[model samples]
Target: MDTEAVNNARHGLRLLLVTLLLTSIGFFIYYVYRQALPKPLPGIPCDEVAAKKVLGSLPSMFSHWKQHGVVMPWLTGHNLKHNPPLVQFFGAPFAQPTVILSDFQESQDILLRRGKECDRADRTLQSFEGMIPHHHLAMRTNGPRFKGNKELVRYLMSPKFLHEASAVQIYEKSLALIDLWSLKVKTSGGKPFPARQDIFDAALDMVSGAAFGFKDDLSITKRQLNHFLSNGVKFKEHENGSVDFHGFLFFGYIVAGHETTSSSLSWALKFIADHQTEQDKLRQALWEAFPDAAAEKRVPNVKITTTHVPYLDGIIDECMRLETSQTKITVGSWSVDDMHLFKPERWLKTGDSGELVYDS
Candidate 1:
């Protein structure tokens, strides 16, 4: 009786062990498969050659997209156009996943609506961190540090402060710029100079003062900032077990603040020059508004307020709309989200009406 009972119990124990082992094996296999599967690189070409070409083409693409919005057809071919237009590249190996975003609705969802569920895409933050430490205020979410920084910025950029700062900084700088441009004109006997330089000089001066202090001599600071922003620089270690979070704020301001604005102003001038009738109409509007030529000559002596030229303000707004300075903002994340480019029109949610919600 004892032998039979022991044998029966042993058989039962073996069966139970076999079942547990099989379950464990199944779970292990599932885990391994999940780990091995590639995360969706939204907006990235599935084809290797096309992805390579995309990385190769970014510098020119970044500039051209600002001038004339480009739809990345290769992305569509790869079934990668589901998200917004984007430009994805970093100083890393090609194995890195691409950056992507959806149209404004998605941006609103991610940035405003479902924002708590989202964070700035990881790889994009990493690239930026490598370039600009702690300067990524927008990417930091609503942390206390960011809160303090924002408060500081708000106080500094408050109406009274901005009014005074722009008076001392932008107005003076604008006069300096015109004086410099006049010198160039006189020296060259009215030969056309690339207006981009003037625009850059003006914007760089303006925003630098706006962001930092009016006293911070951004023109001198920008060169050093550029050097700091070169590719592959180390940033602070990321909180993740990964080393991706090195920061790069020092130079981020230079590029993120100035270049985009400068480009907008440059394109605005170019658009105006190319369309001389529009320019004349605007100039006449300006002349009528200012009225007194004697008083207007004091433009150099006084700050150029909004009251001085209503048409110029309208033109600036129109130019900003027609010529987007930043064509694509990159985003990469750890959640294996799809990466895609963002287009401007989709920014206003026009895609839903066109039945290209995903494709656009």
Candidate 2:
């Protein structure tokens, strides 16, 4: 071929490649933008009229925010007052109805009893990509595929694994957290303050160590584990969402360890902060569990386990309970007489032998 003809061909190929690249970037940008924001599936049977009155639009997003204000209170304070338990609809001509499960048994039946009903809507299949390839447990439909994922999770979470991993990574991170918080608390003159990001970072470190081996650059674990563990830490539980990056777009949700471990840590800290007694108990438990926890020039060398400190376990349980509105969404108008109230002590009761009751 002639030199001019070859040059022209090269130019054309380069131009084509540039066009494809630009188009790809544009598409990806739009996809990510759309994912982070909740959009209305207009035809979904929600109450559009009331939504408009509250938010001034048909496609209103009744997102989770301060689970207390947006959901729990509304469920207990408003919806429960209705005979059939009220539900709200979103969007116009075609609206999506929000199904509030006020009855715990009914929710359990739909989510746990009726297996197929619990499967992720097929619409979610598209979200299986990146670090979580299609076969990832979280992305699978409920059945054999999910079972395989469960088995994998079971192995990863075997007591031997968690206990070993906790000894190597988790407790180390916990100690690092103590140092970070000590400085922060000192800086704030020991006043109540926000430690969400720090907690997220600590959780992220543990998650990264769990998923990927520990890095010499420790904070990278915090950065990547943020995908699996923590996201939107600044947002209240109801308004909460994932913290995945653009590359993790398709892997919408993650299992830092189990379900929402990283975010749960933040909630745990928030709960502890709210209850000084619980916080003090936790501190005392920690000191007891690791006498060298505050030792200078040496990280506490302790093989810690939750069993050693019952109060610490109770604090975690209380944190999870209060997060129901944040995570579970209460339709408690059915069973729980008072779902909005936070009372962690109910989980504790003296047994006939004078031992504290423990039930899963």
Candidate 3:
């Protein structure tokens, strides 16, 4: 062939190479987008109705799950026999490679054996840190300042401190509750009245006393603490923005300590009320244990001691189990830097082998 023909053939080859390169790049971009996009989870679409029901009857639902040792099929559409709890998160996407441990052994291993593997710096933490700068002491026990403060907290908030504080708070709040109930009953001419508000007041007072060394009067301390938490530290107003780590911890503790404790006590009463015979037994036991303080006026003098009441402890423990507040703690994650945050995709999904995988 002539030199011109050879040059034309080379030019065609160059054009073909460029076309192939462009095609490959386009395909890559599309693939990345698909991987990153938050696709609608196959069957579960948030299920607002189910969520409402679950929240409304949280106690009973948790009780059923605990008793059965598996999430109920009616609620979760899964069972222990065939559909294991591990697959519940198979379809969703998260920032971390999370191992959903439904089995007792697996859960114990992840939560206990390898808890440190899962770090807890997430979007929520950003909000929390902003709201409460001091919340970090509860989470990360690093740095000299944190370490020293933690040691101080450990010593000051020891079991002895807790016991004394709890005893005084419970006794005082219970007395206040008894008075409120009696007054309400008198005003209502002994008719049945809603006890929830009164119970909530007592629980709030108790938690306030324990946490802040004083009852909650919705003062600056309480308002600042709770308001900062509810609103979060608005680091940014746009749909997406960073938050404070301390604020996140504040929310965690509020739920962990205050909410959980109140729910436990409330459930304890509910359980006893459900089982009248058990309640009667408890009343009799209380009287026997505190014979001198059995009278209405002397009730405030009655103290709750561990040795004096084994059954009461058992009941409270059972109530806690029934409440199932333990399983709600979850670790979430998000990109801390702005450059990493712009990529809107990267969610959790199961790998080809049907195992959960993180793609952040």
Candidate 4:
């Protein structure tokens, strides 16, 4: 063969190899892109725009969280947008889509009755496992660890245990909270002051005392009260401010109890403060229920307090229904009307004896 023809043949072979390499690279890239896209489960409703995106609903969720400082509302808002009993969203890139059941009865059935069919999600287990490896919350229901852990704490939920053991500690913490609030009221001189931290501290103290058997001296609410009383420090009324924290270790207990209770109490306080009529009714009912304590200018003990104060029970039930600390799914079909309104009366009804009774 001629030298020029040999050189042309070698150049043509090199061009063919480069073309195959580039084509292979292009196909790999396309394959990865397709795999990264959202995959909705069969027959589940999902946002149409989100299904097309690589990150699915995450970008929109992030945007909503940036604006609102929380994401549950955004997730719940999807119910309104889709108008469905169930909606799915991709929480992360290349993750299985999360199916959110908005119907209250259906959610309850799945969570309570259909345990064999629907168990805890992997994301929930992963979240707890990172923080508390051996905690029962991190384990599946069918797992031996979960059964053993549950057996260990089964007595904690008994009414006798709660009344005999937990109630006294909680009552002491409650007194500390009242004292702390009284000081704040005097210092603020009728001006509104931030109560979120105080509420959280009180809740922490109550939980710590009940769970760990901490004494009154170690109570957060008591310590704060003593600090203000000893120093005579006047609280500065501010729209928003940061407070100093005494160092303490964060635990799964805080996640399981403290945050939930504090958030619920904070909402309860806000709702009562906003509605004067309901507040008055609650006070009147309490005073009437505990006439001796009211006459003596003393708060009722745990026993008396637990004895049905219908209005107070109604207020508590209504507050929990209105601003639940956990994620807000849609209400049941029966109670969907005026669910947004803070009306304690919704929980009150005429009993068989024609007396006002608290209804769940």
| TM-score for all models, in order of appearance | 0.53, 0.59, 0.53, 0.81
Off by over 4 Å in 4: 2-7, 41-46, 77-85, 229-254, 326-354, 357-360
Estimate, for each residue in 1-360, the C-alpha lDDT of model 3 and write its tens digit: 699999999999999999999999999987765554333234433333322331323454466678886554434443332255553222222232222344443454565556467534454456555555555423443334565544534633466866677667667666666655565566567888666544654676666566556654432233333443465442111121232323333344444466556666776777777877767766776687677667653662624644345445445544543453444323234344632221212234457997434443
TM-score pick, better of 1 and 2:
2
Model 4 lDDT tens row, 329-353: 3333346677777788887799899
The residue-by-residue lDDT of candidate 1 on 11-36, one tens digit each, is 99999999999999999987765544
**Could you arrange the candidates by lDDT from highest to lowest?**
4, 2, 1, 3
List candidate 1 segments past 4 Å from native: 1-48, 51-96, 99-119, 127-132, 136-139, 142-144, 208-256, 293-303, 306-309, 326-360
Ranking by TM-score: 4, 2, 3, 1
Clashes of each: 24, 18, 16, 0
Per lDDT, the best of the predicted structures is 4
The C-alpha lDDT values of all candidates are 0.52, 0.53, 0.50, 0.78
Provide the lDDT at 63 for model 2. Answer: 45
- The runs of at least 3 residues in candidate 2 whose Cα sits more than 4 Å from the true structure, single-residue gaps closed, are 1-59, 62-86, 91-109, 129-131, 138-144, 220-259, 281-302, 325-341, 351-353
Error of 4 at 247 (Å): 20
Pick the winner on lDDT between candidates 1 and 3. 1
- For residue 163, give model 3's deviation from the true position in Å: 3.6
- Model 4 earns a TM-score of 0.81
* Weakest lDDT window of 10 consecutive positions for candidate 3: 234-243
lDDT of 1: 0.52
